[model samples]
Target chain A: MNPNPPLPPDQPRFLRLFLASEREVRRTVLAMVPSLADAEDIVQQTAAALWEKFAEYDEARPFTPWACRFAQHHTRRWLERRAIWQRLLEHGLAEELTQRREALRPEMERRLAALEKCVEKLPEEQRRLVTGYYYDRTGIGALAEAQGRSVEAVYKMMQRIRQALLECVRAATAQEVEA
Target chain B: MCAGCDRAGGGGVNFPSPEFDGAVAAVCDGSVLERQAEELNALLRTDAAARDEYLWRVELHARLACDADAILGRDATAVSEPAPVAQISWRRAALALAACLAVLLGGVWLWPRAASQEDIVELVRATGSVSWSSEDGRVRPALEAGARLSEGSLTVEGAASSAVVKFRDGSELTLSGDAELSFSDHGKKRLTLRRGAFSADVCPQPTGHPMVIRTPAAEAEVLGTKFSISAVAEQSTLSVETGRVRLRRLADGATVEVASAQSAVATLDATVKMEASSRGVAAARWREDFRTKPSELWQGSWLPAEGAEPARMATVPHVAATRKDGTKVITQAVSRKDSSAGRIVSLMPDSVLTMKFRMQRSKPVTVLLSRHESSGAFAGNYELVVPPSTGQTDASGWRTVSVPVSSFIAKMRGYQQPPSGGQVSLVYIVCYDAKAGMEIAGVAIESAHAGTSTNP
Candidate 1:
């Protein structure tokens, strides 16, 4: 690493902890907000907030859970300002979501592991679609336009692929459980 | 196939969930209908099982969609994609073929800094006046060819100017026409191009940290790709010539993965949604009826085609113009330069530019075309000045003007020649005065012989 210059002494520590916990913390925010875009924004804001408050953090305890707490706070604050999120949050779903998402983390991780194989198993056409839309980050509209399909048609195909992958992962998990 | 997903089946209650699955998929796809959002929220709000499924699906989406490399591996993701930067020669390459600086310099650089300064990048080539400075506003040193630079900012000034740099990793970044790039290969390759255009043929980066290019409106995360970026204050546009790039708009945190030959725009203020990113407009196809989707190529004051026929109309924008005295001028005309994140089509010699609009008073409308060498350097500018109409107009009061490419007089200073063969990059329509009440309803750059309707 080229000493990137500007830093406090503990900057490396903050970077190490943040990089490790980023994926989990991102999942937490994704659970809060429906938008991957907004989740990314909240997670970025949470990272900034965490770095500022790093001195206050009890380093002995796990940083993942601490970063997650900040992520949840930013997600809620982000949601609070938007009228679209107002009705969604009226039932006070954040706390329940945080609690429930933690409960599902283990199985979800297993399913995520299974997804790699399942994705590889997809037909080349389907795999390219996944790579283009999911990996390449092509928008649904752009994907539709490129593939010469209607936007609705593309969404339906994506739904089918996700659903198929879900089934494939579940089967793989079941085989593991049985074994 | 399993009947239903059961890992999402904890709390032991599995409500038949095909409909729920569809809703969650829509959420992940960003195509969730308003009704679906409400329904999906209601299910999550009321039931724990639904929330379990939601978390499960979203996590899967997050890993597969956002964390693609970690899940699929780099080898699987990077291959078989568009790679437009395939032809770069390692020792030196022209920036957009716009720079013949390497041939001009003979030596790679004008001068190298003191040996003590860490040489991280090589200015392999440059054209016109290129400036260099440290990240902060100070340290103004004029940079020349083959100069090894410590991590800092570089700006290629003038429409005709360009520069290409080779990084420590052999990655090549090209800056064209009034663009500034502040770059560092420190921990990972990161470039901040706040304004103007930057193109690159990136070398594959480390597994986790991809190269990042930040503009005012968005940032592009590149994992070894051939791409070009153009940005103004309000928007940053990314066009991927090869491979793919993920462009995230800072305004909405929205990101789109642009693939080869495709472009995506992230805007900070414009209300006009981008129509098409794929740009291969035919000579006859180059038209603006002000209907349906608005092209990213246009910016102007538009109005509904009133009186004649009530049909579909796109957007209405106000186009202000410069008066002869240079006062009473809005001077801001709809331009190809500002929104030129699209097709780089060269104008055939006989190309005719036309416009349909209504003016409150008779005023001369000026059409200006900014041309560049086929190599992408600004050659000169030409203008066609149409005198105020003394012709009949339809009941709607819209007058049509069509001027062939040959009619445009050489109006450029410093360089004077007709723009007969140069690639036409900038096209705009201006009027003598904004108060002349000109509202442009349509415009087109067409081959001279292409049929055009004359509004009676």
Candidate 2:
């Protein structure tokens, strides 16, 4: 018996499309919702809503765009409930900001592409801290307490590290553009 | 600071400012104060440059959170526990209690079980392997029937394990399979289903405070209702039998009102989907007499009620396989072709299963009730255990047992749920032991909700 049985025709198509485009969809939500946690929430909701509404998708169009559109819609809905985000959506700045981000998409992607290499060049300890803080979703306060450092000092250090990574990504991207 | 506006400041979301960088960084790391959050929100709404900078930081954050495990050669941050707790002492206690339960005195050894003042809840009954422990890591003294505790964790180990807990207010929670639940009822009733499948009958609470149940993926603020929730690390599913429950996805803070007969799933990825569950099995009653041979049987012969034997189906198990120590013998019978081909036999919640049988085996006997939906969808498989304590008093060794079908729990976890007015496609009598001897007089099912019993 073949242990790896083929998925039902409907499921495989959706899963393949979704998996191929998930990172792009998360990136789309990240443009407007800058907080990783909140953007992640919107992206997850968008994924479910997309799956539920997958049958209605226009196959002629690209999958990532459709997925991003769903992500944007969910992000807008999510934003409309909160205080500042609600204001942004209501005042139409959220749309304008989206347009601005869309125009900057190429630059952003280039920078994102260069990020791994830049991260690889960081000191081993700094790399661990970056990965620990960002990837592990560890609370800053908890991290600080565990490391026997003040939360403020940790945040300041994190800010400096982020600035360094940003500079490195920009430099790498600029070099790529020159090349 | 993911998204908020409950602080001070309106619109100073300036780019390249020290305060802006500080605020954004603080928010990203979840250490933002109220004032900083309000200021950040203002900046995000008004200034495009500020939004751009913030997005870059957030994009970085998002990438790291998503691929941290990959970057570190490990999995991403775990879906944090509902609340951190669980000890292996529970497994030890469970094993020890299981050993104690195996011992029989003249058949049934009745242990003294009574509720004490410290007990806000009592363990009404426990089947299969179960263990209990407190929040601070103290094992329960005994796994008695009426095991009571003010607050502690009760875990049912193995797929076959299940335990019923009843509160002082008559609210009940049933935990099944390899699941753990930590509970306390001080000022407000609180239960954290760390991991497991749990069903609850919650009573009306005090005005402001509702019964709060926290799982990894979902949180339920239940006022009063009958609901079942299955909690796993990545997802928590809720099925409401009656009344209503407010279920919140902890990941996204999205809330949904799950009404009666409705079901919902809160996933770790923060998706909440609500839909109507199965219509459930239509109510019905059934009975079977060993007038003829069963639909399926192995290593068995039918005895036509000769002498004092009554109409019986006798099975003497023969070795089917050999293990290192000895031979493994198994006997199973699915009662006659009454539910053959297209016919559907519905068994409701209040259905009473009455069986007359005699068994000669070291292990306890199991009655399996397998079911399917009217649409031919696989529903679930349920079982009722006849423990060794139900001794054979008479010389003939025959015993009559009638138990509520509601007592028949699911045979496997994370599968279809237990019988709730569902179609009975198969009923099996099984004995697992070498040289096992089993004799079945008859079997009958009487569902009060549907109608009276019938002679077949």
Candidate 3:
């Protein structure tokens, strides 16, 4: 079976995951901090904190749900610092979080667009290799054996391919402004 | 492995399969992947340099991915701290006292202690620039006119004049004209250039308390590295020369970690946008503001005008003709005093003493062109309070402000009376603030015939 199946036009799994996680993080943080601004600050802090502590994460598990748990912890800490009345005010705050989640979707889409432009500029074979690894989760060993090359050679080639793609994006964007 | 390749040969070779693995290892280690990978990549129709460069980036990506995995592994369960000993227990109280003493001592050794109030210095200038000359005669412009310089902190009126500051740690910063900048000399340094263009090459301290450059539009902090920043009037731009700089805009408050050769521009009214450059292109420059050569100052020395009396109390120093942006510098030693102010006095007849230099600051500066009265005591008169708003931060290109000696020191006895009879000893271009000191970085005095005569 082909591992890299295209998503349907109606399917918004990527968008859904991005927005849902962003919204949940915001909502969970707001539960602790009564102020919308303060909640946003905590959410951002939590995201950065998550990134900084990324080594603790397990790639096998889902990232969004795990990130939401971190958001909840930070939110609880924020709420604990506030007055009792603030706690009562935020009881139904999560219900209003959908708007913020939807608002962030466009920004994510734009970044994805930039990423697409960057990836397209990669050499054709490199592009295929990246797509296979990221999208199809193909093992380096399997790829190497299939091509009758060692795993080291395959991994090294993959590394160069990724670097080339990154450079292509940088040059494209830099020239865009210079032009 | 081929016999030639096994000897760690130079470029130009077709390597066997085993030698290719060695070359791949070399690329992974960031050395030039000598012959094998280059040859194989050629066969694979891949760009050799691109492949080598990508190896480093992919390693970083894998590291980041690994870090993500580690963060996810933290036990979500809360770990409680040990209970504090009750005051009722005498042994616990003694142990707590020892711990407190140890902590205090350790902190004193680890962190620099705050200097006593007497050790604190307050140097202020309203409309002057300050520069430091090294033993080798290399003069560094530390602050520009219409700016204030104090103990480890420099603030300029964003609209008046921009300042290019170099910290002791080799961090170079150019504050956009008219921005307020404050720097703490602590190991974990802090810089707050409230509004204006600012760029720095920050060296991080342990505990990684970022060296912060705060502005109206954004805040850029670094752990340890080189970078440049231009805090435009309403927008701030950050470009990393080496290492990573974290930029956080105050609006949506998005934070981005900018790697080397990458730049981000954030404005008060716009969303933050970032762009990256090729590594070689970005690493070449680390400073945000550029200055003309230091030797430019020594190139044109003042020569007494023909038929003019050797520089006397009444005669203004003569300088070679200069453009509107050109600066004429006069050097003098200043004595440290318990209570003192900077004054420019002593003039010669037909003297056209002009205070012309670049200005960058946001607040109004009380520029005093003062000379001592007959009593030989410092006096404040002939003050030109240039408004805070009148300079460019970016085109900052160059503009000159010329105040005639007659107009500048008119209120003084020499300018008020005949230039021959009145004696002017001390002159001052002092900021009115008793604390926020000003820096007179560069100054020039044009001969009376500055406009007409080419020879000094």
**TM-score for chain B considered on its own, for each of the candidates:** 0.44, 0.43, 0.30
> lDDT of candidate 1 vs native?
0.62
- What is the iRMS for every candidate structure? 13.9, 15.0, 24.1
Q: Give candidate 1 regions above 4 Å deviation.
A: A1-6, B1-19, B82-456
Leading candidate by DockQ: 1
TM-score for each predicted model, relative to the true structure: 0.41, 0.37, 0.24
Q: Candidates ranked by TM-score, best first?
A: 1, 2, 3
Worst 10 residues of 3 chain A by lDDT: A82-91
lDDT of 2 by residue, A2-90 (tens): 75555335655776687677767776776666555466557656665675677798999999988888888888777665543453334
lDDT of 2: 0.62
Give candidate 3 regions above 4 Å deviation. A1-179, B1-153, B156-178, B185-187, B270-456
Better by DockQ, candidate 3 or 1: 1
Chain A TM-score of prediction number 3: 0.42
Output the number of the TM-score-best candidate.
1
lDDT of 2 by residue, B1-456 (tens): 111222223455466777777777655643344456555656677666777777677667656554444443331223222221232223123322322232212223222211111355666555455667775466653243445555778776543346666664556677754578888876578898888677776666667879999998888998877777777667787777778788888888888888777677787674335333543443486666677654442225777756766878775442222232332223444243222122235767677778888767646777766554453333455888888666444677777778887788875332355567556645667666545577788777777656533322
**CA RMSD for every model?**
21.8, 23.1, 27.4
lDDT of 3: 0.40
